[model samples]
Target: MSIDQDLSHVQSLLDPSEVIPPTSPLYGPNAQGWAVQKDLHPRLVAVPTSPESLARLIAHLYKSHLHFGIRGQGFLSASAKDVLVSMTAFDEFHFDPHAEVATVGAGQTWGAVYRKLKEAAPSYAIVGARTPAISVGGTVVTGGLSWLSAEYGCISDPENMLDAQVVKSDGSVVWASTEPDLLWTMRGGGGGFGVATKFLFRVRPYPQAIWAGPILLPRQQLPTVATRLEAFLASNPDPRVSMFLYIIRKNLLETIGAFQDMLVVHAYDANGEEHGREAFKWALDIPGAVDQTGVTDMEGVTKLQQNVDKSKGTMRQYWAPLFLKTLSAATITRAIELVDELAKQDSAVSDCTYLIFELFALCDAKGSCAWPRPPGAKHVILIGAGCPANASAGQEEMARNLAEDASERILGSRTVNLLANGGEEFHDPVMIWGENLDRLRQLKKVYDPNGRFQGPIRA
Candidate 1:
């Protein structure tokens, strides 16, 4: 069928408020979230308010040859000519105290879920992203990292994901959690495995309040501080404490606007601040370093999570993960040298940061979810580079090349949340899934025979 024919079908199925035509003023800004390139635009944007309505649209889309992109919070960095489906309106929140589980709609964000949960149930918490704006469905489906990851595992661990309400390619509503095969795919397999309208996450006991925050230090101290941090990880003192190392080249905020390498320690202790202080002892003890630690609630932590919020859609960006086998002084030294090299070019590695994601041992590959930590990897080294939105084409390429070059130095697997930022760059499934690629492919074939769902895997 023609594009107009498809538009007309969607128009007849959903209300005029739900379907945003190409000419609608609301369409342009809504589409702007995912369309990083100015030249790219969607043919149409659809927001179905209910499952029955969304199912109808999916049924129609499946029968037609139209390619569509699924969106939650419009966080995608890629823009295609296909129709974009926004699941923002399918909002539903229900917590089962007896089963210790929460069923959240795909349209909800971690912040929203946290707020709702806070008002209703304060004792339990769902594993999710640090930022409140990030969607629940997108993060959990991609093996989301969290402060509690050491105690538990990735947010999308198969054991924690009890069930999912999925909309099949054929337009039928099926409870995917009933089958082990479908449940495994939903856990860290990425959102291309059909439309998951509602996700059931296993809730864990959360502290009513905890002590956490960042402690800044001079960039010159990275060598000594990193060695101590390596020693801290080697101790394996407590699973509740997490550490993130930020080598900020663009932190022109304080201390005469000088660039510095900062260590932000996160302690999930409900009782004492001693463990968090010990975890980052070397850096916190540094003279002239800024102290930003305190005892606070999750809301305080969410507010502190405003780290890289400045350049969301306003810049041309590239981000990817690097898995480090160990956080040795050698690795830290190599990273500092590379960042210094990139800084010489233009200093675009401003907000590029890495976290000491301890406890990959907690992530067991015995479940159905295909997401696994790289063979011997321990820390998640996330690298990012960004330039102004109006940056010259050559300049943008240079920035991406710099980040890619830094990532090439360390051999690691991919993180799920960042699967969309590969603009015009093809990321091999093998690098992410390894031997599990074949199994994911076979499952994709069974669930979606046609190449309809364009997720991370392309079998």
Candidate 2:
């Protein structure tokens, strides 16, 4: 059948308000997430308000031979060519204070969840990476790692994860946590298994206070700063301290060719006031060119971390992660040199360069979670770049190429997320795309045989 006919057939099966056509303003609106790839106009759009409507919509779409992509708060990097399913209309928040768990609808944002949880209960699980605007569903499925990951664990860790209501490929709405394997796959696994309608997560006690802010340093002191940071991380592996380093350049005349004053360091402390103060002092003493630190609550910290102005046009960003068994001085020097070289490239691309080093040690209930870990992998280093959507296509390609080349030169044998670049094939023997892809495909066939769910731009 033709695409239009298929969409029409699916639309016939749902309430008029639930289905939006290509001509609708919401079909290809520019309010979606940071990636330009997610801007495609789907043949039709479905916004289900309840589990029953979602299941029915899925079943009808399957019968009509149409594929569908699930979106939460319009935050994703994949493109869609068939039906686009927006979960915005499904927003619902419920917290069981006694159980210390929050059950949230797929459409809710971290900000929404935070307000509801704070009002209903004393505390809740740490939401997305310091950003309240990010959608809860997208981050949770993709192994949501935040500043708290070092202390607690990735948001997907099974101990804290109670259950999820997902609509499977067969148009059956099943509670997935009942099965062990299914539960494990859903946590760290991307959104390929099914459309998660609800999440049941263990919430922690809210912190009485928080200390978080940024530290700016001269680029020339990066080498020395790197050495100090390595030693500090080794000696004091405090989960309360999280840091991110950036090497930037700009095309503007004043900052052009200037690389000295570009590095910024961001740290967060979730432990109470006294401990937070000590952590800040320790971080400031790391022998950098400059340092700025302060104390704030959850709301203040999150707003600062995930602040993306919606007024700007779509954003094109890329994220790449590297896992290291140890953060040696030599490794730090090599990484610094690589970043410095890349920073000399086009200003638009170089200005957006960000390097984040995250330390993850097995904590109290570590073994209970399902986050995949290599035998000795202890630290995760992520290098990311973001640019305006209207930036030149050539510049985008150059930025991606530079990121891949820099990663290879600095860290020889490390595993990075395959989905970061549309699952682009990598060269390192330790990085096996075939095995990961095969396992992911098998799980997809089992849970989403018809491939009703969309993610990662490939399946």
Candidate 3:
């Protein structure tokens, strides 16, 4: 644990400028993750500019048996106490029109990628993360659930993720598909096998403008909204339509001097305005509702999504994904009750918390994913609880408990997502990869035998 000795060794191998010690002002921010609770301190941070440099650093760390974590856009918590490798320098994006594919660097954010696509490839779309700020590489390898997932499946599915370039523990760079096992494990099996430098994504046709926007209604209308949502799910809506229902208190609703709860519905229709409006006509017609629904292109849709997801920045946040067999009336009612309980238990926590219900139509594109998609389930409920950055440990624990309790009540079995960091230790690979757990572990041993890489699933 000689910090100076390790820093000197690392600096000798790579450029001195690439190595950042804790003494540096940049180290403070670089060490912290998106969530304040994951404010871990790494002994040193490495910022490699090229894949060859990354390979060299990873190889050295592996040979020395030093554990390091890869940081991409700081979306997930890093397991770095020794060395942290920041992928920001790898920001590269190239789209090929003839091949209809995109070569996206691991460091690129969905927001940057979306903007580029809008300018050069507006007629094409890649299955990408809904939130604009989330990193591309982290989302894909960890099982990306995108707005277009209903149509094209996960972004990491074999169909969408055509190929990937990874740097193995031995410092040898190779296409993941060359090692069939590595490719399968990387496809939604979760990270830790190796450092995925970049990926080739097959783009789909984005021919028409989509109808999307948010509508805010009084929380008292939960029952009525729930009934309609239940029917909407049961009615087998078009695959082109995806909707998110959120129960949020007004304190976080960007409204001043208002603490009342509000039900926010964000509806999207990929089929255009006419059909999109008709499908969600019931919700639009609700009285005393503040509706902002309209037709917009992909850029507008992405901007709307970014605006709605105000969960980023320096804050203590916890979110858990609860998959339901059916969005029945009873289930909806119980969910509402859980949200209410959370609010009543702690007023301070309630003001900063919100619950989300993702209602998607029947999609057949999840068959090729490594992460097991819950069978017979179309709705995934996520409860997000947060506290202030400077909150005490007890306050953070209270917020986490509120979110986890609600998630457990609705969950029939455990589901894992790197983003669903609700104070749960995901050391069990079975919970994440499910049936592919054994195979993924075998590949981990083969590729990362010394366990130099750190991720949710431990080898």
Best by lDDT: 3
| Model 2 lDDT-worst window of ten | 417-426
C-alpha lDDT score of every prediction, in listed order:
0.66, 0.63, 0.74
Candidate RMSDs in Å, in order, are 3.4, 3.9, 2.8
Residue pair clashes in candidate 1: none
> What does the lDDT come to for candidate 2?
0.63
Tens-digit per-residue lDDT, 197-239, candidate 3: 8999988688457889888877777778878877888877777
lDDT of 2 by residue, 222-289 (tens): 66667777776776556666666555343322434444555566767777656755655544665543
Ten residues in a row with the worst lDDT in model 3? Answer: 417-426
- Candidate 3 deviation (Cα RMSD): 2.8
Q: Which residue pairs show backbone clashes in model 3? A: none
Candidate that scores best on TM-score:
3
Taking all chains together, the TM-score of candidate 1 against the true structure is 0.89
**Which scores better on lDDT, 1 or 3?**
3
Kindly list the per-residue Cα lDDT of model 1 for residues 174-193, writing each as its tens digit. Answer: 88866678878877776577
Q: Which stretches of candidate 2 lie over 4 Å from their true place?
A: 28-31, 123-128, 247-260, 286-292, 309-315, 359-371, 375-378, 385-388, 391-393, 414-440, 455-459
Candidate 3 local lDDT, residue 289: 77
